[model samples]
Target: MAWKFETSGLDGQCELFGVNIFKYRWRDCRETAAVTDPHYGVEKMFHVYEVEIDGQLRRFAAGEFSNCVWGFYLEQG
Candidate 1:
Protein backbone atom coordinates (compact mmCIF):
# COMPACT_ATOMS: atom_id res chain seq x y z
CA MET A 1 0.00 0.00 0.00
CA ALA A 2 1.17 3.55 -0.65
CA TRP A 3 2.14 5.70 2.34
CA LYS A 4 0.59 8.97 3.24
CA PHE A 5 1.70 11.70 5.68
CA GLU A 6 0.02 14.74 7.12
CA THR A 7 1.11 17.21 9.78
CA SER A 8 -0.77 16.94 13.06
CA GLY A 9 0.91 19.35 15.44
CA LEU A 10 4.12 21.19 16.35
CA ASP A 11 4.84 20.43 19.96
CA GLY A 12 8.38 21.30 21.15
CA GLN A 13 12.02 20.24 21.39
CA CYS A 14 13.25 16.79 22.29
CA GLU A 15 16.83 15.77 23.03
CA LEU A 16 18.33 12.93 21.06
CA PHE A 17 21.96 11.87 20.62
CA GLY A 18 23.17 14.84 22.70
CA VAL A 19 21.37 17.37 20.52
CA ASN A 20 18.00 19.10 20.71
CA ILE A 21 15.58 18.14 17.96
CA PHE A 22 12.23 19.70 17.25
CA LYS A 23 9.18 17.47 17.55
CA TYR A 24 6.41 17.20 15.01
CA ARG A 25 3.37 14.97 15.00
CA TRP A 26 1.58 13.45 12.06
CA ARG A 27 -1.62 11.51 11.64
CA ASP A 28 -0.05 8.39 10.11
CA CYS A 29 3.48 8.09 11.50
CA ARG A 30 4.15 4.58 12.72
CA GLU A 31 6.38 1.57 12.30
CA THR A 32 6.42 0.19 8.79
CA ALA A 33 5.53 -3.31 9.87
CA ALA A 34 2.69 -2.06 11.98
CA VAL A 35 0.98 -0.14 9.23
CA THR A 36 -1.33 -1.45 6.57
CA ASP A 37 -3.45 0.54 4.16
CA PRO A 38 -4.75 3.67 5.87
CA HIS A 39 -8.25 2.88 4.71
CA TYR A 40 -8.26 -0.79 5.65
CA GLY A 41 -6.46 -1.66 8.88
CA VAL A 42 -5.91 -0.29 12.34
CA GLU A 43 -2.24 0.31 13.12
CA LYS A 44 -0.06 1.96 15.70
CA MET A 45 0.33 5.68 15.12
CA PHE A 46 2.84 8.31 16.22
CA HIS A 47 3.83 11.93 15.85
CA VAL A 48 6.07 13.41 13.10
CA TYR A 49 8.15 16.58 13.23
CA GLU A 50 11.01 18.59 11.72
CA VAL A 51 14.31 19.71 13.21
CA GLU A 52 17.03 22.11 12.15
CA ILE A 53 20.46 20.56 12.18
CA ASP A 54 23.41 22.56 10.87
CA GLY A 55 20.98 25.09 9.40
CA GLN A 56 18.86 22.50 7.60
CA LEU A 57 15.36 21.62 8.64
CA ARG A 58 14.82 17.87 8.57
CA ARG A 59 11.65 15.89 9.02
CA PHE A 60 11.16 13.21 11.65
CA ALA A 61 8.62 10.92 13.26
CA ALA A 62 8.19 10.16 16.97
CA GLY A 63 7.37 6.84 18.56
CA GLU A 64 7.16 5.72 22.17
CA PHE A 65 9.53 3.17 23.63
CA SER A 66 9.77 2.28 27.33
CA ASN A 67 7.57 5.24 28.16
CA CYS A 68 9.92 7.70 26.42
CA VAL A 69 9.55 9.39 23.08
CA TRP A 70 12.00 8.53 20.30
CA GLY A 71 12.67 10.46 17.13
CA PHE A 72 13.32 9.05 13.68
CA TYR A 73 14.44 11.38 10.89
CA LEU A 74 12.86 11.10 7.50
CA GLU A 75 14.90 10.94 4.32
CA GLN A 76 15.66 14.24 2.62
CA GLY A 77 14.19 14.97 -0.78
Candidate 2:
Protein backbone atom coordinates (compact mmCIF):
# COMPACT_ATOMS: atom_id res chain seq x y z
CA MET A 1 0.00 0.00 0.00
CA ALA A 2 1.17 3.52 -0.72
CA TRP A 3 1.93 5.64 2.31
CA LYS A 4 -0.59 8.40 2.82
CA PHE A 5 0.33 11.96 3.75
CA GLU A 6 -2.15 12.06 6.62
CA THR A 7 -0.11 9.35 8.30
CA SER A 8 3.06 11.34 7.75
CA GLY A 9 2.82 13.04 11.15
CA LEU A 10 1.47 16.06 9.38
CA ASP A 11 -2.10 17.22 9.10
CA GLY A 12 -4.24 17.16 5.95
CA GLN A 13 -2.80 20.52 5.02
CA CYS A 14 0.18 19.97 2.74
CA GLU A 15 1.38 23.52 2.24
CA LEU A 16 4.30 24.19 4.54
CA PHE A 17 6.17 27.47 4.55
CA GLY A 18 4.32 28.25 1.35
CA VAL A 19 5.68 25.07 -0.28
CA ASN A 20 3.46 22.21 -1.33
CA ILE A 21 5.24 19.22 0.18
CA PHE A 22 2.60 16.86 -1.16
CA LYS A 23 3.23 18.27 -4.61
CA TYR A 24 6.57 16.51 -4.37
CA ARG A 25 4.60 13.26 -4.21
CA TRP A 26 6.19 11.74 -1.16
CA ARG A 27 6.50 7.97 -1.35
CA ASP A 28 7.22 5.11 1.03
CA CYS A 29 9.21 5.33 4.17
CA ARG A 30 12.80 4.23 3.76
CA GLU A 31 14.21 4.17 7.31
CA THR A 32 13.81 5.61 10.77
CA ALA A 33 16.22 7.26 13.19
CA ALA A 34 15.95 8.56 16.74
CA VAL A 35 16.81 12.16 17.49
CA THR A 36 16.53 14.56 20.43
CA ASP A 37 15.28 18.09 20.42
CA PRO A 38 18.08 20.67 20.50
CA HIS A 39 16.20 23.93 20.60
CA TYR A 40 13.85 23.45 23.55
CA GLY A 41 16.50 21.52 25.51
CA VAL A 42 13.71 19.34 26.85
CA GLU A 43 15.31 16.22 25.34
CA LYS A 44 12.19 15.07 23.53
CA MET A 45 12.57 12.08 21.24
CA PHE A 46 11.72 12.33 17.54
CA HIS A 47 11.53 9.74 14.80
CA VAL A 48 13.36 10.72 11.68
CA TYR A 49 12.19 9.10 8.49
CA GLU A 50 13.82 8.92 5.09
CA VAL A 51 11.21 9.05 2.35
CA GLU A 52 11.01 9.52 -1.38
CA ILE A 53 10.03 13.04 -2.42
CA ASP A 54 9.74 14.09 -6.03
CA GLY A 55 11.36 10.81 -6.96
CA GLN A 56 14.31 11.75 -4.73
CA LEU A 57 14.98 10.60 -1.22
CA ARG A 58 14.78 13.01 1.69
CA ARG A 59 14.63 12.92 5.46
CA PHE A 60 12.02 14.21 7.92
CA ALA A 61 11.54 14.02 11.64
CA ALA A 62 8.17 13.16 13.21
CA GLY A 63 6.98 12.46 16.72
CA GLU A 64 4.85 13.65 19.57
CA PHE A 65 5.84 16.86 21.24
CA SER A 66 3.29 16.68 23.99
CA ASN A 67 -0.05 15.04 24.74
CA CYS A 68 -1.29 14.40 21.20
CA VAL A 69 0.85 17.17 19.83
CA TRP A 70 2.84 15.92 16.86
CA GLY A 71 4.76 17.52 14.02
CA PHE A 72 7.33 16.93 11.26
CA TYR A 73 10.20 18.86 9.79
CA LEU A 74 12.14 18.38 6.56
CA GLU A 75 15.69 17.39 7.30
CA GLN A 76 18.35 19.82 6.28
CA GLY A 77 21.52 18.81 4.63
Candidate 3:
Protein backbone atom coordinates (compact mmCIF):
# COMPACT_ATOMS: atom_id res chain seq x y z
CA MET A 1 0.00 0.00 0.00
CA ALA A 2 1.06 3.55 -0.71
CA TRP A 3 1.42 4.94 2.78
CA LYS A 4 1.10 8.68 2.78
CA PHE A 5 0.37 11.07 5.64
CA GLU A 6 -2.56 13.35 5.08
CA THR A 7 -4.29 15.89 7.28
CA SER A 8 -7.97 15.45 7.95
CA GLY A 9 -10.53 18.05 9.00
CA LEU A 10 -9.86 21.49 10.45
CA ASP A 11 -8.98 20.17 13.87
CA GLY A 12 -5.43 19.37 12.70
CA GLN A 13 -6.12 15.65 12.82
CA CYS A 14 -4.19 13.21 10.64
CA GLU A 15 -4.75 10.01 8.74
CA LEU A 16 -2.43 7.40 7.36
CA PHE A 17 -2.92 6.38 3.77
CA GLY A 18 -6.51 7.63 3.96
CA VAL A 19 -7.40 5.56 7.00
CA ASN A 20 -9.15 7.38 9.81
CA ILE A 21 -7.37 5.83 12.72
CA PHE A 22 -9.50 7.49 15.34
CA LYS A 23 -12.50 5.61 14.11
CA TYR A 24 -11.17 2.53 15.85
CA ARG A 25 -10.63 1.89 19.53
CA TRP A 26 -6.92 2.04 20.32
CA ARG A 27 -4.94 1.33 23.46
CA ASP A 28 -1.72 0.00 24.99
CA CYS A 29 0.54 2.60 23.41
CA ARG A 30 4.16 1.84 24.18
CA GLU A 31 7.35 3.55 23.17
CA THR A 32 10.11 1.46 21.71
CA ALA A 33 13.79 2.13 21.09
CA ALA A 34 14.86 4.50 18.41
CA VAL A 35 16.09 3.13 15.10
CA THR A 36 18.25 4.47 12.35
CA ASP A 37 17.62 3.94 8.71
CA PRO A 38 20.31 1.78 7.18
CA HIS A 39 20.55 3.81 4.01
CA TYR A 40 20.05 7.42 5.15
CA GLY A 41 21.11 7.01 8.76
CA VAL A 42 18.09 8.95 9.92
CA GLU A 43 17.17 8.13 13.49
CA LYS A 44 13.50 7.89 14.44
CA MET A 45 11.56 7.03 17.58
CA PHE A 46 8.36 5.09 17.39
CA HIS A 47 5.32 4.23 19.48
CA VAL A 48 3.51 0.96 19.05
CA TYR A 49 -0.21 0.78 19.61
CA GLU A 50 -2.99 -1.79 19.45
CA VAL A 51 -6.36 -1.07 17.92
CA GLU A 52 -9.34 -3.36 17.57
CA ILE A 53 -11.10 -3.04 14.27
CA ASP A 54 -13.74 -5.42 13.00
CA GLY A 55 -12.99 -7.73 15.96
CA GLN A 56 -9.35 -8.05 14.89
CA LEU A 57 -6.37 -6.60 16.65
CA ARG A 58 -4.29 -4.32 14.46
CA ARG A 59 -0.96 -2.82 15.27
CA PHE A 60 0.30 0.61 14.39
CA ALA A 61 3.63 2.33 14.64
CA ALA A 62 3.68 6.08 14.87
CA GLY A 63 6.46 8.64 14.77
CA GLU A 64 6.69 12.36 14.70
CA PHE A 65 9.00 14.89 13.04
CA SER A 66 8.61 18.57 12.26
CA ASN A 67 5.34 18.60 14.20
CA CYS A 68 3.80 16.16 11.74
CA VAL A 69 2.89 12.59 12.64
CA TRP A 70 3.57 9.62 10.41
CA GLY A 71 2.66 5.99 10.96
CA PHE A 72 2.38 2.53 9.60
CA TYR A 73 -0.81 0.48 9.56
CA LEU A 74 1.04 -2.72 10.36
CA GLU A 75 -0.88 -5.44 8.58
CA GLN A 76 -0.29 -8.82 10.06
CA GLY A 77 0.50 -11.64 7.70
Candidate 4:
Protein backbone atom coordinates (compact mmCIF):
# COMPACT_ATOMS: atom_id res chain seq x y z
CA MET A 1 0.00 0.00 0.00
CA ALA A 2 1.09 3.52 -0.73
CA TRP A 3 0.99 6.36 1.76
CA LYS A 4 -1.62 8.96 0.95
CA PHE A 5 -0.54 12.49 0.07
CA GLU A 6 -1.55 13.77 3.49
CA THR A 7 1.30 11.87 5.10
CA SER A 8 3.71 11.61 2.18
CA GLY A 9 7.30 12.86 2.59
CA LEU A 10 6.49 13.31 6.25
CA ASP A 11 9.94 12.19 7.30
CA GLY A 12 11.77 14.27 4.68
CA GLN A 13 10.34 17.50 5.96
CA CYS A 14 13.00 20.12 6.45
CA GLU A 15 11.12 21.17 9.54
CA LEU A 16 8.36 19.53 11.51
CA PHE A 17 5.63 22.13 11.93
CA GLY A 18 2.41 20.67 13.09
CA VAL A 19 0.50 18.80 15.75
CA ASN A 20 -0.23 15.19 14.85
CA ILE A 21 -2.48 13.19 17.09
CA PHE A 22 -3.47 9.57 17.06
CA LYS A 23 -4.78 7.18 19.69
CA TYR A 24 -2.54 4.22 20.49
CA ARG A 25 -3.56 1.52 22.87
CA TRP A 26 -1.02 0.75 25.55
CA ARG A 27 -0.58 -0.29 29.20
CA ASP A 28 -2.57 -3.43 28.70
CA CYS A 29 -5.49 -1.51 27.33
CA ARG A 30 -7.36 -2.93 24.37
CA GLU A 31 -10.79 -2.78 22.81
CA THR A 32 -11.55 -6.04 24.56
CA ALA A 33 -10.97 -4.56 27.98
CA ALA A 34 -13.90 -5.23 30.21
CA VAL A 35 -13.12 -2.57 32.77
CA THR A 36 -12.26 1.09 32.47
CA ASP A 37 -9.61 1.50 29.83
CA PRO A 38 -8.06 4.60 28.38
CA HIS A 39 -6.67 5.00 24.91
CA TYR A 40 -3.56 7.07 24.99
CA GLY A 41 -2.81 9.58 22.32
CA VAL A 42 0.08 11.92 22.59
CA GLU A 43 -1.66 14.47 24.74
CA LYS A 44 -1.98 17.83 23.05
CA MET A 45 1.28 19.69 23.03
CA PHE A 46 2.48 22.98 21.57
CA HIS A 47 5.19 22.58 18.94
CA VAL A 48 6.86 24.99 16.58
CA TYR A 49 9.14 24.55 13.60
CA GLU A 50 11.66 26.99 12.29
CA VAL A 51 13.60 26.92 9.06
CA GLU A 52 15.90 29.53 7.59
CA ILE A 53 14.66 30.52 4.18
CA ASP A 54 16.74 33.28 2.66
CA GLY A 55 18.08 34.16 6.08
CA GLN A 56 14.59 34.83 7.34
CA LEU A 57 12.73 33.11 10.12
CA ARG A 58 10.08 30.83 8.73
CA ARG A 59 7.97 29.59 11.60
CA PHE A 60 5.23 27.02 11.23
CA ALA A 61 2.89 25.24 13.59
CA ALA A 62 -0.31 23.30 13.56
CA GLY A 63 -1.74 25.36 16.43
CA GLU A 64 -4.83 23.23 16.88
CA PHE A 65 -5.60 20.34 14.60
CA SER A 66 -9.20 21.49 14.59
CA ASN A 67 -8.72 22.37 10.92
CA CYS A 68 -6.59 19.35 10.01
CA VAL A 69 -4.37 21.25 7.61
CA TRP A 70 -1.00 19.80 6.55
CA GLY A 71 1.56 22.27 5.25
CA PHE A 72 4.93 21.84 3.55
CA TYR A 73 7.53 23.79 1.59
CA LEU A 74 10.25 22.80 -0.87
CA GLU A 75 13.05 24.83 -2.40
CA GLN A 76 16.35 24.39 -4.19
CA GLY A 77 19.60 24.94 -2.39
Top model by TM-score, which number? 3
Best by lDDT: 3
Q: What is the TM-score ranking, best to worst?
A: 3, 2, 1, 4
lDDT: the better of candidates 2 and 3: 3
Clashing pairs for predicted structure model 4, backbone only = none
- In candidate 3, stretches whose alpha carbon ends up further than 4 angstroms from where it belongs are 1-18, 29-41, 73-77
lDDT of 2 by residue, 1-77 (tens): 11222223244444543455545544446555444443464544455555554456665655665555455555444
Between candidates 3 and 4, the one scoring higher on TM-score is: 3
Residue-wise lDDT of candidate 4 within 1-77, one digit each (tens)?
Answer: 11111221232232332432222111211112111111233333333344444445543322232344333222212
TM-score: model 3 vs. ground truth: 0.52
Alpha-carbon lDDT, every model: 0.42, 0.48, 0.51, 0.28
Pick by lDDT: 1 or 4, better one: 1
Model 3's lDDT to the true fold?
Answer: 0.51
lDDT of 1 by residue, 40-61 (tens): 4455544554555666665455
Instruction: Evaluate residue 51 in candidate 3 and report its C-alpha lDDT on the 0 to 100 scale.
Output: 76
Q: In model 2, where do residues sit more than 4 Å from their true spots?
A: 1-10, 14-40, 74-77
TM-score of each: 0.38, 0.44, 0.52, 0.26
Residue 51 displacement (Å), model 2: 1.5
